[model samples]
Target chain A: EPEVTQTPSHQVTQMGQEVILRCVPISNHLYFYWYRQILGQKVEFLVSFYNNEISEKSEIFDDQFSVERPDGSNFTLKIRSTKLEDSAMYFCANPEGVGYGYTFGSGTRLTVV
Target chain B: AQTVTQSQPEMSVQEAETVTLSCTYDTSESNYYLFWYKQPPSRQMILVIRQEAYKQQNATENRFSVNFQKAAKSFSLKISDSQLGDTAMYFCAFMRPSGTYKYIFGTGTRLKVLA
Candidate 1:
């Protein structure tokens, strides 16, 4: 079966450094999203993208965070300056564009020191 | 706002036994979607099963099935003949039926299958 794939399975960065987590969603899907899960915490929504633009976002998706569909298959999340609290597993998910079930990627584990 | 709650933080079952994981949600919108996802140690999210709020009939996939109660706003997953590979963190999620519906996931129920 076709599955979403993310690059950099694990990443470690300094608290003030920048990091980019990437994902390639299923080809036919239309909607894309980013969610973060702090260790032992609930996954929180960050942002959702479609038509190369942000559709909706949560409070947690603040100025420090941004998402880009730089290319047809590539969706990325960039953190301008990482914070220690930013450490968490970032998941990329896609829904059946028009409307439907969600399928998530393996996740990129971001660790800030 | 939609919230999914998975009461049991953890559960254990024998390899061949049956196990039920409970889930509940708060949503007044008559149209929506309920889902159960499995996240293994690899942290890969896998879609297990889904139910449409409007459909009274529950959804089942092989040994994995769900008991969806629309009136009570409850959706539980039942795994029959569980196997060692069934061990994982099970998450119950909710989404709007149409429009821009992002998923709201529960903390998750960790299941350990003992042989």
Candidate 2:
């Protein structure tokens, strides 16, 4: 089965440093999303992208965060300056089809010191 | 706005037994989708099953089945003949049929299938 691929399985960075998490969604998928789960907390939606632009974003997706479909297959999420609270497991996902289901990547664990 | 709630934080079932995880949501829109996702210790999100709000028939996949009550706004997952591998955190999610396709997930129910 085709799966979403996310780079940097685990990352550790200083609180003020920048980090870029990358994902390659399923080739035929039209929608892409970023979700984060703080330890012991529910997974929260950060942003959704389509047609080369952000379709919607949650309150957690603030100025410090940004997402890009830099190219045909690569979708990336960048954090300008990480905060200690930013530590979480970030997952990239895309729907199998319109409301059919969603396939999620293994997730990039971001740890900010 | 949509909110999914999984009231049970943790549950355990003996191997080969049946277990059900409960989920409820609040949504005014009649058209939407409900889902149950599994997250093991590896922390990978896996789609288990899905139900379209308009469909009254529940969805089932092998040993995984769901009891979807549209009137009560409830969607519950039932795992039959549970195996040790079934141990994981189960999340119930909600999504609007149109617009951004953003998903709202519940806090999750941690299920342990004991050997």
Candidate 3:
């Protein structure tokens, strides 16, 4: 089965540095998303991308965060400045289409020190 | 807003026994979708099963099935003949039925299969 793939399975960055997490969604998938889970918190939605634009985003998705589908296959999430609280597991998911269940990638564990 | 709650933070089951993880949600929309996802030690999110709120009949996938209660706004997962490999963190998710956006995930329930 085809799967969503994320690069840099684990990343370590300084508090003020920028980090960009990358994801390659399933080739035929139309919708993509980024979600983060704090050590013991719920998985929260960051943003959803479709047609090269942000379709939806949650309150947690603030000025510090931004998502871009630079090309047809690559989706990226960039954090301007990392904070200690930014440490968490970031998952990238893709659904066949809208309203369908999403297939999640292994996840990239971001450690902001 | 829609929210998913998994009250049980942790659960354990004998290797050969059956186990059920509880999940409840609050949603105003009449039509939507519910899902069960598993995350093993590898941290890979895997789809366990799914149900359409409009469908009254329960949805089952092999030993993994769901008891979807539309009236009570509850969707629980039942794992039968549980095995050691079944140990993982289980998450119940809610989504829009029209295929519009991302999902709302529960805090998650960690399941351990004892040998």
True contacts kept of each: 0.56, 0.91, 0.77
Per-residue lDDT tens digits for candidate 2, residues A1-113, read 98899999999999999999999999967688999999889999999888777888999999999987778779889999999999999999988888887899999999999
Residue by residue across A2-86, what tens digits does model 1's lDDT show? 6888889999999999999999998866678899988766778889877677989999999999988777779989999999999
Q: In model 3, which runs have C-alpha deviations exceeding 4 angstroms? A: none
Error of 3 at B110 (Å): 0.7
Deviating ranges (above 4 Å) for candidate 1: A97-100
| lDDT, residue A55, candidate 3 | 86
Superposition-based RMSD of candidate 2 using all C-alpha atoms, in angstroms: 0.9
Task: Give the lowest summed-lDDT range of ten residues in model 1 chain A.
Answer: A95-104
lDDT of 3 by residue, B1-115 (tens): 8999999999999998999999999989998889998988887888899888888999999999998889899999999999999999999999886545688899999999999
Sorted by lDDT, highest first, which candidate order results?
Answer: 2, 3, 1
What is candidate 2's local distance difference test score? 0.94
lDDT of 2 by residue, B1-115 (tens): 6889999999999999999999999999999999999999999998999999999999999999999999999999999999999999999999999998788999999999999
Query: Docking category for candidate 3?
Result: medium
Q: What RMSD does each model have against the real structure?
A: 1.4, 0.9, 1.3
lDDT of 1 by residue, B10-61 (tens): 9999999999999999998998888898988888888899888889999999
Residue pairs clashing in model 1 are: none
